[model samples]
Target: MITEQAPGKLYIAGEYGVLEPDCPAILVAVNQFIRVSITKTNSAAGIIHSRQYSQDSIHWVRRGFKMVIDNRDNPFEYILAAISYTERFCLEQHVKMKLYDLHINSDLDSSDGKKYGLGSSAAVTVATVKAILRFYNVPFSNELVYKLSAISHYSVQGNGSAGDIAASVYGGWIAYQTFDKNWLKQELNHKTLSEVVSEAWPGLKIQLLTPPVGLNLMIGWSQQPASTSRLVDETNANKAALNGEYQQFIDFSRQCVLEMINGFENKDIHLIQKQIRVNRQLLRHFARINQIAIEIPRLSKLINIAESCGGAAKTSGAGNGDCGIVIADAQTDVTALEQEWRQNGIMPLDLHVHQSKIKQ
Candidate 1:
C-alpha cells in the first residue's frame, strides 16, 4: 500500500493579482490536509473511494490505450483527473503501472464536514498525483508533481492561478508566480499531457517566502462558504463591462501586492499595516464594482473586532465568504477577540505557519 497526504492552504496576500498570468502571490500551507492511500488489488479493475465522497467505490479499468472511468460525476473528480493524467503521462513515457484501490480523506473541514475554504481540491489533487506517481515507481520532483497537479486542476476548474496547488505541493510560505495561462492554453491546443509534463515550462516561476521577524498571524472563518468561481465570474464580468476600468483595478491590486511583499521582506511594520488596510479597501472596491457582497456580515464583524484589537482583517480568498485573516501585533488580545468571534458565530482556526512542503 502507498499513502500520501498534502496540506490545505491560505493566501496571505495577492489573491486576485495572481490571475494576471504572471503576477506573484504570497500564500502558506496550513496543518489541515487531504490524505490519499493506495493499495494493490488482485482484481483486474481498480476502485476509488473517498470518505468525503459517496460510500460506493468507483470502478475503473485501463483499456489498451485509454483509462475508462465508470463514474464521470463522482465527488472525487479531481482525484480521478489526477489518476487519468498520471496514467497518461506514464503511457506517454512507456512506464508500466499496476492496479490499486485508492482511498481519500481530509481534515480541512469541520466535524460536520463543512469546508472552511482551505483549498481542499488543490490538496486532494496534489496528494492524488503524488500517490499515483509513486504507485508506478515514477521518479518525480516536487515541481513535477506540482505541474502535474496544476494541469489536472486546471483541466477541471479552468483558468485557476494554481496557488493552492503550489502550496499543497511545496508545503510552506510561498511567494508564487502564476504561469501564463495564455501560453498554457495555446500549448494544450497541440500538446499531449505527457509532453506538457516533460517539456521545460519556459516561463513558469515559483519562490518560497519568509514572513518578517516577530510577525503575528491569525485566521478567522466566517463559516459561510463562498463560491470563488462565482465571485471571479462576477469580477470578470464587471471588468469586461467597462474598458480600462479593469486596468485601473489591476494597477491598484498590483501596487497593493508590491507594498505587501516589500513591506514584509524589509520588516517595515507601518508599511505592512498600511498595505494590509489598503488591500482590504481595494478588495471592497472590487466588490462594489462587481456589485457582489464579498464581505459578508460575519466577516464585517470579524474585521471590526480585529481592528478594534489593533489588527487588520479582510476576506482571504475569493471573498463573499469563507475565511478572513487577521494581522495583528503580538500584544493584541487574541483571546478576547476569539471570544467575541465565538459570540458572533465565527470560528477562529489556530493554524500556525507551515515551514515545510510535501514530505515522504
Candidate 2:
C-alpha cells in the first residue's frame, strides 16, 4: 500500500489580498490532515473512495490515460484530474503507471462531522498527487509535489492563491506568492495536460519560515462552514465599485505580510502582535466598506475575548464564520478563553503548527 498525507493550513496574513498577482501571504500547516491510502489493483480498474462524496466511490475503467466513469455525479473529479495530470508528467519522463484502489480520509472536522474550514480539498489534492506519483515509482521532490498540487487544484477551482496547497505540500509556515492561476489554467486549454505538467510553473513562490520562539497560539471554530469560492466571487464582484478602498486594503495587507515574516525571522512577539492587530483592523474596515461580513458576531466576540485575555486575535480565512487565530505568551490564561468560547458555542481546536511536509 502507498499512503500519502497532507496537513491543512491557517492563513496568518494576506487572505483576500493574496488574490492579486505577485502579492504575498503567510500560511502555517496545522495538525489536521487529509490522508490517502492506495494499493495496486488488477483488472485495469481504478476505485476511488471518499466519504464526503454522495456516492462515496468512483468505479472507473482506465484506458491508456483516460478514465471513464458510468455514474452521473462525479465525486472524484479533482482526484481524476490529479491522476490524469500526473500521468502526463510520467509520459514526459517515461515512467510506468498502473491502476490502484485509493481510499481518502480526513481529520479536519469535528467529531460531529462539522468542517472547521481547514482547506480539505487542497489537502486531498496534494495527497492524491503524491500518492499517484509514488504508485508509478516516479521520482518526485517537494517542489514537484507542490507544483502538481497547485495545477491539479487550480484545474478544478480556477480561483485561490493556492497558499493552502503550498502549505499542505511543503508543511511548516511559509511566505507564499501565488503563480498566475489564470495563466496556468489557460495552458490546460491550449495544450495537453502532460505537456503542461512537464513545464516549469511561471511566477510560483514559496518560502518556509520558522516560528517565533515562546509563542502560544489558539484556534476557535464557530462551527460555520464558509464557502471560500462564494466569498471570493461576491468580493470580486464589488472590487470595481470599491477600487480605492480595495487598493488601500491591499497595501496594508502586504505590509502585514512583510511584518509577519519579519516577526518570525526576528523572533519578536511585539512585531507579531502589532501586525495581528493592524491586520484585524484592516479586515474590519474592508468588511464595512464592501458590505461583506468578514467578521461576524461570534468571531468579533472571540477577538474581543482574546484581546481581553492578553492575546491578539483575528479571523483566519475568508472570514464571515470559520475559525480565528489567537496569539499570546505561554503565561496567558487561555483556559478562561477556551471556556468562554465553549459557552458561546464555539469550538477551541487543539491545533498546532505541523512541522513536516507531505509524508508517505
Candidate 3:
C-alpha cells in the first residue's frame, strides 16, 4: 500500500487578481490535509471509497488504457482526472499498470462536511497524483508533482488560478504567480504531458517564503461555504462593465502583493501587517466597483474585532463567505479576540502552517 497526503491552503494576499496570468499571490499550506491511499487489488476492478461523497464506493476498470467508472453520478471528478493524467505520464515512462483500490480521506472539512474553503479539491488532486506515482515507483520532484496536479485540476475545473495546487505540492508559505492558461491550452493541443511539464511555462513562478519570527497567524471560520468559481465568474463578467477600474485593480493588487513579499524577505512584521491592511482596502475597493459583497457582515465583524485587538485581518479567499485570516504580533490578546469572534458566531480554527518534507 502507498499513501500520500497534501496540505490544504489559505490565501494570505492576492485573491481575484491572481486569476490573471503573471499576477502574484501569497498563500500558506495549513496543517489540515487530504490523504489518498492506494493498494493493489487481485480482481480486475478497482474501487474508490470516500465518506465525503454521497456514494460509499465506485468501481472502476481499465479498458484499453482508459478508466471506465461504473457509477453514473461521479463525485470524484478531480481524483479521476488526477489518476488519468498520472497514468498517462506513467505510460510515457513505460511503467506497468496495475489495478488498485484508492481510498481518500480529508481533514480539510468540518466534521459535519462543511467546507472551510481551505482548497480541499486541490489538495485531493495533488494527493491522488502523488499516491499513484509512488505506487508506480516513479521518481518525482515537487515541481513535477505540482505541474502534473495543476494540469489535472485545471482540466477538471476549467477556471481559477492554480495557486492552491502549488501550495498543496510545495507546502509552507509561498509567493505564486499563475501561468498563462491560454498558452497552456494551446500547447496541450499538440504537446505531450511530459513535454509540457519539461518546458518553462509563461508567467509561472513559485518561491518559498519565511514568515517573520514571533508572527501570529489566525484563522476564523464563518461556517458558510462559498463557491469560489461562481464568485470568480461573476466578477469576470463585470470586467468590461468596470472598464478602466478593472485594470486599475489588477495593477494595484500586483503592487500590493509585491510589497508584502518584500516584507517577508526583510522579516518586517509591521510592514507585513501594513500591507495586509492595504490589500484589505484594495479588495474592498474592488468589491465596491464590481458591486459584489466580498466582505459579508460576518467577515466584516471578524476583521473589526481582530483589528481592535491589534491584528490585521481580511477575507481569505473569494470571500462571499468562508474564512478570514489575521496577522498579529505575538503580544496580542488572542483569547479576547477569539472570545469576541465566538460571540459573533465565528469559529476560531486551530490551524498552523504545514511545512513540506519534499526537498526544494
How far does residue 31 in candidate 3 sit from its true spot (Å)?
0.3
Of the candidates shown, which would achieve the greatest TM-score relative to the real structure?
3
Residue pairs clashing in model 2 are: none
Per-residue error (Å), model 1, residue 87: 1.2
Query: Cα lDDT for residue 153, model 3?
Result: 88
Worst 10 residues of 2 by lDDT: 69-78
| lDDT per residue (tens digit) for residues 1-360 in model 3 | 899999999999999999987689999999999999999999979999987765435556687999976431233888999999999999999999999999999998899878899998899999999999999999899989999999998887778899999999999999999999988999888989889988999999999999999899999999988778667867989988898999999999999999999999999999999999999999999999888889999999999999999999999999989999999898678999999999999999999999998744
> If scored against the real structure, what TM-score would every candidate get?
0.90, 0.89, 0.93
- Candidate 1 pairs with clashing backbones: 170-357, 171-356, 171-357, 294-320
Against the unseen true structure, what C-alpha lDDT does each candidate score?
0.80, 0.82, 0.91
In model 3, which runs have C-alpha deviations exceeding 4 angstroms? 55-75
Task: Give lDDT tens digits, candidate 1, residues 1-360.
Answer: 889898999987777767875566778899888889999899989998877766535556687889886442233778878888888888877887778999988888777767789998888889999898888888888878988999888887665689989888887777777887777778878998767776767556777667777677789999887656656656666666855866777778777877777877788766777777887887787777777897888889998999888887777888778899887877678889999999999999989876654433
RMSD of each: 5.6, 5.8, 5.4
